[model samples]
Target: MSAPAREVRDVARAALAWASGRRADFALGEDALAADGQVDRSWKPLGELAQVCATVTRHTPPGDPLHARAADLLAFAWRQTGEGELFLRLQRLEPFATYPLEVYAALAAAGFRHPAYEAATATVARTRGWRLTEQEPTRRLGVLHAEERGGIHRDEPREPALRRTWLGGLPEPWTFERSAGYALTHVVFHLTDWGRAAGGVPGDLTDYLAHWLPPWIDTCLDARMWDLACELLAVAASVPGLPGDTVPDDAWARVAAAQDASGALPEEGDAGDPAAYFAHHYHSTLMAAFAAALTAGQGVPV
Candidate 1:
């Protein structure tokens, strides 16, 4: 393999090792509590873990130990609770928030088939409406999640036009502003299904990302926003016709360097105290693993 590909594979292997070791936490629900003492009383932890495992398995070859482990873990998590209970808990926690929908979408993408997920999503659509179609691009990615993962399909023929308008309204002259960078990455994620469904992204939006993504990745790296930087790597991996080899040599390297020996990458650039390790690092490490898997699997047909 080429140097960059090899680097991504190495990082992916390390992340898989780390994630596999956390199976106990995942199984026993210990990963549900945040460092701030806020417990994820909903299905967020299981959903997130399922998403990570699904994404990893998608890029991994069959018979690969990591792939089999991820699949097994996903099944285990699914069996722990029913979709109806999870959705009901999520509704009680935040009925109007977009996160529940996103979580459901991730589960669906991972091949966790549940009628309750579809029913809950449909109910939310009927009650909450398709805010993603009407709202700003940055705020409505969860809606895109609903659409892409078979949660709620919009029947409007003007969908492409709507996408164009939304893409056009995004703040231009992208800077190192942390929130903006984060939003841009999410915009790309919504457009590309976190790099797994790049073909569906509109051409203009894809072109826009192609132009601005490289410099934005550099800027985020310079600012020590490692989490956002990894997200940008995911965006790069998603753009079609964009050369797989064009990914910056150091992008994966920087994230890998920040990873603890235990396999967690910090939210920012530094690992915080031990007390906050799972809360601060879990999502970032997951994103890094996702980026690494996506990058390493590049050039192979999806």
Candidate 2:
């Protein structure tokens, strides 16, 4: 296997093992269940697990046991909760939030094709109508809205409007700033579905990513922001026809180097204490595995 592909495979294997081992940290337990038989609003870990597993399943090889295991975990979580009803209750409880929409998107991405999931998704979509216009000040919300629409609905309407919003250019004075980098990467991910829908990305937008991504990756790595750097790698992996070298060969290597032997990557280089393992590591490790799977899946050479 090529170096990049091999790196992806190794990282993915380690991440899956790590995530599986840490499932108890995120999985719904009896104590988390509501006495009233409603989905507990405090059980945020379920959503996190759902998204993580969904990413794993999406990028990992088909027929891999991890895929099935992740699916089963998602199903178990959903069932343990109130399923569609829980989502509805959650939506009513927390309107104007993007997380419920994100959960539906993750389940859909993972190929969970239940009617209840579909219904819950449609409810959320209708409730949170497309917030993709430039007027939406929180760029992340716009990106999240786009992700739900494109990832779940597969309906890329308002093409001209979307082009106007994203293709106009990234937020001005872009730097290695962490939040800015994350917002930029998420906009690209929503546009490209983390490389699964590259044809949907506009030429100008793709060019914009191509121009800024390399430097952004370098800056984030230099800063030891492993999670954000992995997200930038994911953006590079998404742009179609961008040369492999655009994503530095050591991009994945740098992220892998930061990972603990148990496969968790701290949010930053200095936060690797085992006592705070799950709190510090899940997001970055998940993103690293996600980047690896996404880049490798594209058959892109490093």
Candidate 3:
């Protein structure tokens, strides 16, 4: 590698290492760290270490609520502030949920941009949990409304009108748990896109290839069993009966490069399919080649 390329890679490595160390410390639980440090067990450590980890993870953007919370929670966890362990624990209960958002915030601070921001927003719509309205043909209730208080209903065989309201009560805790995994994956996808752009465009694909692409491909797989979803979505959009081709060739190229000929993706033509030679195959192949031409090692082309 050239001096500049080596330098960039080294810097990225250092940042990742620092971030990973902070994450590990937080995972160990701040109190445990302090107790081990022998600071006196008479008082709770109040998780000062945890807060520092959070701040480092997010890079502490100015005026962010999370930033403020991290600070307060750190103080409380360490017993430096009035807040207690109960409150601090409650506040940071969903670091996974916060993680994705923090990644985006970090990217912004580092000057990364993404063309898929809108596409990502569409994916989040699935998380909103809406009732399926519209008449049902049989006994299945056609309309699904948020549970009503003491709502009286007759079990009917035919389609019913649909309605939806807010899900009430303390809210199912698992709802957040289930959603966090999916949400984090989505967030990671966006970051991967940004990384790909950064690494490929300006002349540095190494970071993306070594650090980002593997999990990035996994993210796509998490979204769908096969690359077919994106391909299908594209085909649907491209044809009259479908959504109509909205995503540009550049976007398609990124997706294609993530795949391989064997369908396992991440490598060159590993799978063979004569049918793919047509629209699906050609699209992926063409876009990937174009991406390759832009300048390997740099990142996404402008």
Decoy 3 TM-score against native: 0.18
- Tens digits of per-residue lDDT, candidate 3, 57-169, equal 24324464333543443433334322223222322442212222222232222233332432342243234342232322211121111011002133332212211111111
Measured against the true structure, the TM-scores of the candidates, in listed sequence, are 0.81, 0.78, 0.18
Pairs in steric clash, model 2: none
lDDT order of candidates, top first:
1, 2, 3
What are the runs in model 2 whose C-alpha is more than 4 Å off? 28-45, 65-69, 76-82, 113-168, 171-176, 272-275, 300-302
Candidate 2 C-alpha error for residue 47, in Å: 3.2
Each candidate's lDDT (Cα)?
A: 0.67, 0.64, 0.28
lDDT of candidate 3 at residue 203, scale 0 to 100: 17
Among these predictions, the greatest lDDT belongs to: 1
lDDT, candidate 3, at 31? 52
Per-residue CA lDDT of candidate 1, range 189-265, in tens?
Answer: 66666667658666766667667777778877777787888888877876777654445668777777888898878
Candidate 2 C-alpha lDDT tens digits along 255-287: 777877988888888655768767777777777
Cα displacement (angstroms), candidate 2, residue 8, comes to 1.7
Against the hidden true structure, what lDDT does model 2 obtain? 0.64
